[model samples]
Target: MAQGDMRDRPRHAGAGDRQMTALDPRAMRLANAETVLRALYGADALSQAAIATATGLSRRTVELILVDLEAEGWVRVRSTEPHASGRGRPARQYAFRSEVGVVLGIDIAHDRSTVAAADLRGRTLHTAVVPMPGEPERAERLAGTRRAVAEALRAVGVRPGQVGSVSVATPGNVNDKGAVDVELSMHGWTGVRLAEEFAPDFAVPVHVENNAKLAVLAELWEGATPGADHLLWLMLEGQYNGMGIVMDGVPYRGVDGAAGEIFWAKGLGLDALTASPLIGLGRLEPEERRAEATAILERAERGDPAALSEVDSFADVLARGLSALSWVFAPRYVVLGGWLAWALGDLLATRVAARMARNAPPFVAVRRSTLGPDAVVRGAIRAALDRYEWTAARPLAPERRPSPVDGG
Candidate 1:
């Protein structure tokens, strides 16, 4: 837990062209709902005719879909005068509702777990963290995560049932069963069923994602590099080293959701560095280990000979590993994150960038994470928030409005 850090489609169908009557009711309903949603999403507000033009549906059909969306609390209907004027009655416009409910974000890490309760629009209502036990089992970790979630909700005076969705970010890989396949070498963490841990208790959908990947999500959503299609997120906490890939603004989870497990790049993360003779760095006490990295970085910053030596050694290894990865993926931007990024700071970034510059042509930029330690958890929150967006963006059933009467 670093600390709280700073901020920052559709087919067209004509009304009387015979396509409407030939279309299936279910699909037409879904398509109309989508058109209405697109009209609202694409604009601040859209009248039925505006939506009709954008969707190629009749104004009455747009009205029917608007009724359904409003009924489901997905849109807010407002009566306003048409821009063209000459209307005896105000025309109705629709706007997407942003505050339908809240989503839960949980970050379960090697040291601690945090839970954040936020509105659908990604506004944080409350958040809390619980320290993980020195030795935790499947049940204990789940219990701890649940406690944090409960506390977060309670802090905000919300109920479990009110949560629309949940996303969990952890140090391990998410397996098919929704359990995180934590590296066996990790301390106090192993076979943990992240989905079962929360799913049984909460009716909302539960999503388990790698912390680094989640951090990448956070960055892609809001960070220094926004909307970069090709990105590489490197998570280098002393305990773990991995990469998260975002292809075209979407996470590239492999067939088994292990695409970011780049730690195996030339056996760098096959096992803890303790197993490697070159590094010769063994796992110290959690506090000592964390402090040691910070101290080494501090000394390096001051140009200490020994600290500089160690930093150079680590940088060599990282450069080699990153170079190998870059040769393959060739990401546009590589964002350094996790505790190691915080400890090493710009020194590490510059070092890595210099090494990567050797690759030539299509140089991948190296930058420090703006979200800091909260990146992964915030990304989890983002995952939860995405559910709301997806659900709302989807098509829904709508009533078929009566045909308009033509005045000859």
Candidate 2:
């Protein structure tokens, strides 16, 4: 492992570990050791007997594996308490070490950016939001993002060297190479290489992803659409507007990372209908367009004639677009996100379902995003943790298995 850099190295693989081939008996032993570590991860510690019962292994086998893992610094012996009988040796307790390092998640909006730090276990340690210069250059946005991340790391008592990985959510087409090849929200941000800028600052692996796509990923991971393997996230209102498609529980960013740029395809003559209702609301306040849009929807929900007409027209166009996309993707769930979704959730949901239900498939369920505005950031954090896992414990692959002995 590289010194002070956990980005590309395993957390517990030491120099003393013998290289074990697939045929080596040590391979299975390593696998069993991983099982024990997983059992301990859910709880503070586990007794040898408990681990053996949980792993379906004998007490002696559990003891041997713990001995090896303890030597490897992956597990620590907490205590050896004697049984109440007093004649027998104390039961051995072991715990998985979770404080090896931290990860960072950065979410960039058109006018603002947020930074968060979390441990490998996905527990948030610190978070901060900082304003970005309006319509700034790419370098200026990067500088602001870096400053916010530094503040978060410092608040969490972590240094750049301690961050195992960093994930950034931006409004753009993030290609497979992890670069923001096309950023719509950040001016002069095309071809923003995430690793090139962040590697020098944090010395950790960096991931740049589409904000809408990350929100969908977050929803699938641990949000409203859990187990909704096929999903279409229609961000109803956002500063950086777009859609995010997910197939089989994974984001679909297209061949050129522009799969969900459907927002650009204006249709159904929605501009004249959805636009005029909120004409006077902004009153020279160009920034209040989104908020005014939300207010129009709210009034429509209350059966106001003008507002209702405008909102129904918007929903008509929205359903038309959704119908076309549904014919192509056939998602199981449609997650309505962004501030508009938050402001007028059930109202807009009911309206859209009523309109699009006939054209779309029957299995597709539409719902509002429960994580609200934090969805993208949460997904970015999960992505960062996944990066850490790739380096820290990919071989063990604990998440692939369920613990035999479980403790909350």
How much is the lDDT of residue 22 in candidate 1? 60
RMSD to the true structure for each prediction, in A, is 9.2, 7.8
Best by TM-score: 2
lDDT tens digits by residue: candidate 2, 1-408: 112222212233233343542356765576666567656665667898888887687888888888877775567778778898998778777876655456778898777789977665666777788887558887888888888987886676666765777899887787887787776556888888876678788666688888888888777767787756688887655333578888876778779677887656666333342354433232122656756765876677778998877756656766777877787898988877876567667766777888777878887777878887788888898778656742234222233211211110
- Candidate 2 total steric clashes: 2
lDDT of 2: 0.69
lDDT of 1 by residue, 1-408 (tens): 111111111222346523664666765686567557655655667778878897688878888888888887778877686556675777777776545566788988766779887754566767788897576765677778788988887765556766677898887777766776756544545676767767777767688887878888888877667666888888776545777898866789887677888665546433344332222222223665556666766777899998887766666667767667767777788887766666667877887788778852356787888877678778988788666533333222233111112220
User: Model 2, residue 257: displacement in angstroms?
Assistant: 2.6
TM-score of each: 0.77, 0.78
lDDT per model vs. reference? 0.68, 0.69
Q: Give the TM-score of candidate 2.
A: 0.78
- Candidate 2 clash pair list: 81-90, 82-90
lDDT of 2 at 17: 41
